[model samples]
Target: MAWRKLDKMIRPASCRAGCWRCVYGCPYGAKWTARDFIIEACRDGAHLADRARVLRVLVENGRAAGVEVEVQGKVHAVRAPVVVLAAGGLGSPRLLHASGLGPRCSPFFSDPVVAVMGSVDDIDGGAEVPMAAGLSLHEEGIALADLTLPQPMYAAFAAQVGRVDRLFAHKRTLSMMVKIRDEIGGGVGPRWADKTLADSDRKKLAHGVGMAKAILREAGAHHIFKSWHFAAHPGGSVRIGEGVDADLQTSTPGLYVCDASVIPEPWGLPPTLTLLCLGKRLGSSLAATRRAEGAA
Candidate 1:
């Protein structure tokens, strides 16, 4: 009702969230993603380097001056006056730790999703986009989304069903997912994750599973199965007020860290929109800062 009152609700093409393009890369080039934005930047004269793995941020006089990256089995140093770490939550923390910037940020969380799989009579799940409709079940600390996986993925879920033929009925399958708000209990490592879900997080996930099961059953699905967990929307590593200042400046001047790494909390929502807004704000600030420095 509030969305209607504000006239802010949006119904995308096909009257759904358009999951077909999101899950699988959009062959038609219709999906809006960060790649599209980056491509536009490149067209606007921004240089893009591909496959250069940043080994560490280079610091001189306690200020970030550039980065050491490896490309094609060779190490190279890229120098710049200002260095920005736009690596995501995981990669950013790893890079910072490698550069001896800060200790690894612990108690981070990611959205872990488990899909509830079932089948309804005479329905082709692949007939339309998956997760087209969704609801925010905030009271339960979960978000509900419609789902339709490819045939092989569905088979993996039905592995214990004893009959591969029955499980192969992808068209009759009905899928939904419950994404729970997880507790922060994970630690980010330089190259690997040493994180575990908290007991509370597991309980919340179980509750979400129950909700998914109920919804599927209510929609005439039976022989319910549960898929393994997968993590998405990782954040809360180098958080605001801890790893960086509100201005996104690190202890190293002329250096900044933005992206999901600076998200202070889980948010229980997609990071795309939030990150875009943050990028815009930070871009404006950086431009202004550059202009001021030139004046000085």
Candidate 2:
């Protein structure tokens, strides 16, 4: 095989594969995180209170006035003329309900994932970052992300291999993760989320795994393995048109929502970029609203 040719295809910029640092953090300062935004906001006169968790919105005269938050084992009320709920899908709906809004939020879905694993002789799967290369089977509702998990992470997934010695061959072990677009049939409750895998979603996941396995085998991999099922990126519990308006304003005046909960449907992609774009748009609108109110 052509090692040089494969390297050009698989390598992603500056990322050394099989490093679990992305989980704890990126020490290289390559990854952008919310901390960066919070720091910039603080520099621009935004006040931040660490370890504060909001309990509910405080509504008066059918309008949002403030929020009740818990901090340091004590609950306190903070009053504001305009309140925004940036909590994610789960927390946002729960907060809306706790504030005496509708108890039922719009149904949501999650990215149901299953991974396929195999081994290839003389091929170091960990030579490059996981998911450096991918193929989108859009019509099939499946996407593949190349994976080469670190030893500990790989061992956890390959538990059925059942031998420490065999699990040590991390370099040769290759895997691909299948992220399928699941159905929206789950509700966000006050304290919990109730969701079940629909038959259609199950079929999609199975098909995605089958596609991944075929790719791995064609690349000289053998002794394929399949990991346990999992779900990620719970979203769409609230919607743009149904839960909030285009301006991100909810039915309650002065209350706004700007998060993944506002996504109208399953995007089959990571929501980080989407949320960042939404946040910027919401910030601009809020600034404009404040300016208008001040002029009035």
Candidate 3:
């Protein structure tokens, strides 16, 4: 496994107070998020309707029309020649189901994760940046990373694993995360989504945990234990070939999905960069279509 530092935007000096604002909402704007892009879009004359929720996509004569949404408890129909779904993995599939599009989104993947942690003698751990360094074993469909959770989160993990006695060892604990790319075998609906790990996925996690424990032992850590399994970046609910086309256009013309939901397979790593690239590509494709229509 090749190890390296993760690319993240954080000012360590700003976190001296240990408020952990970065974990929830960075008040200092030190961490980059979708909000930054929204701000830029608004400055470019894009109207952002905050607190609005889309109920369904409006299809007319088997073509894209617009969407029905609710804002401030009132229903409204916003008409458009094109519609793009960027509501993310969960929201996108739910919207599609509600719109009578994909009746059911089945076989999705949620990168299951677990943190293997141990107590170190002297080093302070919880105060550092989380996921600072890590390695990815692509062939094995596993990724390992150094992680330093906030005290409360660490305590929650410890409690989850029935390790209450080690809850107070946040400062002197060394933690590493083992995340596995799980098989797509779940269903998503308008109201609920369900996922279950395959046996292969469980075995992969166990192997990753063993590797993490060995590394922590080499680093002088003891009392090694793993946290309860959790999930991250749930996706593949709306896939490329099955739900959308090469240009990310759905069966309905002029309608597109540009989010993690469109990813075709189980992905082990973070999807942020992938989503950004998809968004850009979709934007360009839409612009080109608009230009062709204008010329015709």
Candidate 4:
């Protein structure tokens, strides 16, 4: 109601509560995005690494043999009876394709995000809880957030030193943004030719940006700006029904995927919760089955 009220308050404008439209387009500084959850997964015992990249999923004789990962230009093969692909939609598809899962096994992917930016006063943008506020506008199936950014990312976002100068010139005038889950229109393609953002998506972004700006203004923000933000969060490749069954185990038995890439809907907020929840569910289910077999 606060967001709706604020959106109404902005009149012809929309504002979300602590929707964090105060910051947008920042990856690391976004604070507590899915990245936080991934970190938690690591803390909770999921192995993660810096600069580690997966090269391919190895399949041998119709089974998930293992995987080959590249670290520092060296390929290391991690042989496992089971393999899981938790990479985002794009990553998953690319991996599956490389491994011959191809279009047949991987399908159903979505990209949902409308990026909007705002500039505020002396906020030290990246210094706070990292866009910790949000409100769900019932009419719109989405949430909002304000975020902070480092100089490097800001520079890229601004696209040049002049924009960066404008940002820092009025240092107190901090920058913020909102990311609305776009309608069913926006998505990722094999390339630019495939990547398309529809008019409805634009409208949603307009709505999202309008709301963020209004919230920032209400919060005492003086300056604001908005740009297009496509959903960086990719998911659905290796869809549940295709490469993996309902249990999240792929056709290549023993293979599993425990990440947001498999989620089937717009999360509205960060997906870490769903991913973690799914992970727990899958793990427990597998553990129980293993125990039953072992006892038998």
Which of 2 and 3 is the better model by TM-score? 3
- Tens-place lDDT per residue, model 2, 1-296, is 11111122212455554565654456666556778889999999999989999999999998888999999999999999899998897889888888887565557887777878888898755544555567676676777887667677778777754545447667788888889888888788877777788999889888888888888889888878888777668888878888898888999999998888888877567678789899999999889988998999
Better of 3 and 4 by TM-score: 3
Candidate 1: where is the Cα deviation over 4 Å?
A: 1-21, 157-166
lDDT at residue 104 of model 1 (Cα atoms): 64
Model 2 per-residue lDDT at 217: 89
Please report the candidate that would top TM-score against the real structure. Answer: 3
Report every candidate's CA lDDT: 0.76, 0.78, 0.87, 0.59
Candidate 2 pairs with clashing backbones: none
RMSD of each candidate relative to the true structure: 3.5, 4.0, 2.0, 7.6
Give lDDT: candidate 2, residue 143. Answer: 75
Clashing pairs in 3: none
Candidate 2, TM-score vs. the true structure?
0.88
How many clashing residue pairs appear in each of the predictions shown? 0, 0, 0, 15
Determine which window of 10 residues in candidate 4 has minimal summed lDDT: 4-13
- Judged by lDDT against the true structure, how good is candidate 2? 0.78
Encode model 1's per-residue lDDT on 29-75: one tens digit a residue: 54555787789989999888899999999999888889999999999
Model 2, residue 211: distance off in Å is 0.8
TM-score preference between candidates 2 and 4, better one: 2
